[model samples]
Target: MKSSRKGLEICCGITATFLIVVALVFTTLWFTTFKPKEPEITAYPVGLEDINVFSIFFVRNITLNMTITINNHRNVGSFEFKNATAYVNYRGGVVAEVPIGQNLVPARGKLNTTTSADLMVGKIITNPVFFDDVAAGSLNLTATAALHGKVRLFEFVKIRATALSTCDISFSIASRNVQSTCKSKIKL
Candidate 1:
């Protein structure tokens, strides 16, 4: 009976040691290979598709095209984004909202999606700041985009994360030139 008890104790010890080793291995792997990371997002203005302004008081119509790029820097994870919308704001008011469809970005990959914003004449003319910016020869606008999705790691571990991007656009009405600066953030 004593020998049997010793054997049982030895088995338990071995099992505990094995579990500790396995846990250590997994912890190391997680820190080195499977950790979550934020994606880099950037926005570029493709061009002004159409711009029509009647004097400094009225904007007949305006259309702006833009490209959004999502870069996944992780070596072991992929991002699956759901349907989202991008908004264009003048001063503090939203002028355009564009839908960005679902997208999948593979590991260590980049995705470029294109969207267009059509500014309504009524929305622009109602804002008194629009006239001031137009009279100054430039239109200052802000473009915002949010991507909500899951990051799949090792085909099993999925983490919910949201990537938000905002870009400040300065458009020259006379030269048709666009200058933009963008910033991005991620929430996990």
Candidate 2:
């Protein structure tokens, strides 16, 4: 009986030690493997909020509305966007630069923002090819956006990334319609 009791005591101690070591290893791995993931952001033209054209003068003022969607996946923490802007590019040239403003995106959540751009349609007419593209029923343009923000990881690790993306956009000049295509390479 005495021998059996001692052997049992030894087994219990070894088991406890093994369990504690396993727990320690797991805890270390948990924190070490955890990191902040880059947030997902996308922007696309939605429609024309306002369009006014004077037939006699051929001057036009247009308000283009775009939808900016952000997805902060879990483990990425929170994002506090300072400023966002989109530059309308035509054939590798910048025609218009619009500030989209700032907002916040929660962790593991999604945010939708509406950005507007005031455009001088008459000025765009200066480019014959641009006018042709618009008259063709689909005005194809590239939207290059810069997002300046800070990412908070577990409310502790804070890092800022100036992310920029080039996205293809299409608008129906005949109607107040817009379509968004996929984004190109994102630069940091």
TM-score attained by model 1: 0.80
Clash total of candidate 2: 0
lDDT of 1: 0.80
Candidate 2 local lDDT, 114-174, one digit each (tens)? 8787665655666668656755766677777777777766788777756566777766766
True-vs-predicted CA distance for residue 150, candidate 2, Å: 1.4
Model 2 worst lDDT run, 10 consecutive residues: 48-57
Model 1, 98-154: lDDT tens digits are: 788899988888989888778665776788887787799988889888889988887
Show model 2 residue runs off by greater than 4 Å: 1-38, 49-57, 173-176, 184-188
Error of 1 at 161 (Å): 2.5
Q: Which candidate wins on lDDT?
A: 1
